[model samples]
Target chain A: MIEVFFQYDFLRYSLFTGVLIGILAPLTGVFIVVRRLSLLADALSHITLTGIAFSLLLGRYINFFAVLNPVYMGMIFAATGSLLIERLRHTYRFYRELAIPIILSSGIGIGVVFISLADGFTTDLFSYLFGSIAAISSTDFTVVLVLTTVVVAIFGLFYKELFFLSFDEEQAVISGIPRRSLHFLFILITAVVIGISMQIVGILLVSALMTLPVAAAMRLAASFKQMFFYSVVIGEVSVLAGIFAAFHLDVAPGGMIVVVNVLILLIVLAATSEKILNRKGG
Target chain B: MKNSAAPYVLEVKNVSFSYGKQMVLEDINMQVREGSFLGLVGPNGSGKSTFMKLLLGLLKADKGNIELFGSPVQSFRDWSRIGFVSQKANSFNSGFPATVFEVVAMGLYGKIGLFRFLKKEHKKKIKEAIAQVGMEQYMHKNIGRLSGGQQQRVFIARALVSEPELLILDEPTVGVDADSVRNFYDMLKELNDKKNITLILVTHDIGAMSEYVTDVACLNKCLHFHGDKNDFEVNREEMMTAMYGHKVNVIEHNHSHDHHDHSHDHDDLDGVRS
Candidate 1:
């Protein structure tokens, strides 16, 4: 495990990607969980699957869009998927769940079609799914870096507005927080986050990477600010530790990361939490 | 200043509002002095909450004008002078980790604005407001840990911390026990007397709130009547019945029930507005 750190540049890139994904996923996930948009994350990630498949198929055919590598192509497609989810969700107020199914099922259907069109299993697609640090290239690394910086900046600028909207939207609007602009900006930020997370966590469990830390953090933190702080810390730990363990075992880092987070959650729940607290609940 | 010396802090002139196509408030007009406790009473759907919203600029009226602190229609930019506490506003999850100070500090979001953080004076004011609400002991406690009444007190403290000229309360007594309602009113009366803050309280607790309020305003969809408590108490039934388009003999009941269950949606009050 220790030798893996310096032996391969892939390991270095993977660790770097894992750390960034760990921070960005849960930061955005805190917004998702608090706003009751957890399902939206899943819906968006499934759409990324379709993007990955398209990138692969196009790489074989037209090749230019894929010239940038499959991951960037997939990211661009997933961002579009994120935007579509927001539009559909907004249009269908009462039946917002309709948007989820449309994006999710269509994404899966596209995945199947593209995989068949490519004929042979691409090494990149498998790595993209279960996650492989071996595939992280300089170009893909650059995109991930830019995406992280943008996501972090957006989150910081719109932090208060987003918090208010999640907690008390009407109050936020009444206070002249420029809610409509903030809402769109928030969705745009989510797309960027989902795009960056695609490499490490894959199209499959990217949403899980976003949500599990927040879910775990909610048990311990007392305020929105504290929740964000702890959720990020928890996410970083799980990803770094899980990726290190996966390196030693030659297993899928995505599954390891999710499992580590779940295990950490259980330990935290056991250590600090009292189920009986609800009895004296306010 | 004499009895008439104080300037009008809030003036609602012939305001009317409709939800979709249904009219809620029709031709409502009222004036509040700089320092006064005004009680709003109606069976339900008396447009009391609607009026408060109109006053707070939360909702726009179909017709009429609202003036705050002698401002012309366009002059009242942000209503920092007006503090508000609505029933739905208390729906924050109890498990929320914010301490009473952090929760109360949110009220200053408008006053403090972005870029600049809260200053020392703001902290002092927050402490003073928390002290005023008698929750200083629980200042560090997570807001979710507090009881319903205490939670409401925290909200009141939040509003008070802003040093609003006109403090608006919309059914703040909801979910609170009967014992707490009196204490809440007493606390309010003290704030009104001590701080000299103008209070406009919309409530169903006519008996208790009425005792503390200097004046009363009754509504159903439009203004029914509003005047000094002495005038209201003297004429009670006759005055209220006459003001409503339909005759109503409201029976005062103990308003100590599951106030936490208070819905923001105004229930349909059958009585007609004057």
Candidate 2:
């Protein structure tokens, strides 16, 4: 595996991008899960898919559009979708979750139209949906690195405020944290993460990367800080193992990574359930 | 200045609030003197919660001036001087992953400022706040693992960790048991009397709070009464009528035995809102 990675630049790019996505996803996922916006990730990723499809459609006509990376367009659409979600949530305050399904459906509806307009699934669309280990280039790796750095920097700068907001939003507001802008910034960050992660995890499986590791970590974590640490560890391990397995098996890394995460979640649940059963029996 | 009389810690004047079309609070006016334990009692939907939110600047009043420490609430930027224990303090997500110490330390976040790390002094303050709430033994435990009452106490510790001059609690003992409620009031009393922290405790049970508070205010869409407990006791009949918007007969029981009776009265009065 080490020899293969050194021999092929694409393999190196895939491994590097996978590791970055692993840390970035769960790091942002902790806040997403705690804030109960886990489904918003799903919504945003689907919107990102629409953006990718639109970019692909444009690529077929205009040479200038073809030169532009689809990831940039995906990010723009994801951010716009995130802002729209926030706006709709505020508009229908009584039914906040209504925003999720509306955006998700719109994304899928628009995505299908674009796909059909482009005359069926191209290799690009398939790779965006399931992620292709072979398609990862050095440019994709750099893009992933930049996105990861931005996410980490934002988390570092706003750690306390973010923690307070996620734990209790009302309290955070009462404490005089600027609620609207911070919330919008959070949504924007979530959008960028889903957008950049499409090359490795793909749009469909992106939310799985964001949530599954945190789900497993929640069972054992004693504190928010510990939850974050455990989630990152779980995420990194799953990504590394999945990428290695995919390399050997010649499969898509996105599906394999999510499978590893599911396995980890099952193992944690099984272990915790036995302890709970024993305690009850005793 | 000195001759003009001391400034109040909080003053709400001509406050009127509405949710969409239905009015929640109308012409509400109240004041809290410095270092006084003011108990705000009212039935559910009587706008006690809404009033608290307005005072905390969480909600803007449609018409009114809320002055905190002599500054208009709109200009009151010194939030660290005020601590708020929200109505859902005990009802927060049970799966929220945080230790007692971490929750308590959150209170100091506002005071610690942005882009700054918590120092040893902040840690010491958190420990002291937890100790003050008598939750030192459980400081390391996950907050969710504790009982509802314990969680409430941790939230109180979180509020106190900021060492605010004014502490406001909005129906803080809602889900707590009778004994825990009694102890909770006792802790608030201690914070008021010993630490000289001004307290505004909003609860449904006027009787439970009547024994500990220095002042009492009854509310039902308006401030029916706001005065010293002695005056409140003198005009209890008139106050009760005004508070409920209907005549309510009362028998004055001895002060020492009011706790048990108050808890019983609250249960029967569960749905009694004007």
Give DockQ per model, in order. Answer: 0.28, 0.41
Q: Model 1: per-residue lDDT, tens digit, B159-238?
A: 77778888989889887777887799999998888888999898766777766888898888867777777878888878
Per-model TM against the reference? 0.89, 0.92
Model 1 chain A: worst 10 consecutive residues (lDDT sum): A273-282
Tens digits of lDDT, candidate 1, A95-209: 7779888988888888889988988677777877777666676677777888789788778766656776676665555555566666677776776677677677777778888
Error of 2 at B156 (Å): 0.9
Q: How does residue A163 of candidate 2 score in lDDT?
A: 92
Kindly report the docking quality category of candidate 1. acceptable
Query: For this target, which candidate reaches the highest lDDT against the unseen true structure?
Result: 2
Lowest summed-lDDT stretch of 10 residues in model 2 chain B? Answer: B265-274
Model 2 clashes, total count: 0
What are the candidates' C-alpha RMSDs? 4.2, 5.2
Candidate 2, pairs of clashing residues: none
Residue-by-residue lDDT tens digits, candidate 2, B13-92:
99998877978889988878788888888766677777877787766789989999999987788999999998777667
Runs of candidate 2 with Cα error greater than 4 angstroms are A274-282, B1-6, B245-274
Q: Tens digits of per-residue lDDT for model 2 on A1-282?
A: 567887889888888888888898999999999989999999999999899889888988999878777878989999999999988987877688999999999999998999899888987788889877766778877877887888899999889889988887777777777666678889999999887777787788999999999999999899999999999999999988888887789878899999999999999999899755764675
TM-score, predicted candidate 1 vs. hidden true structure = 0.89
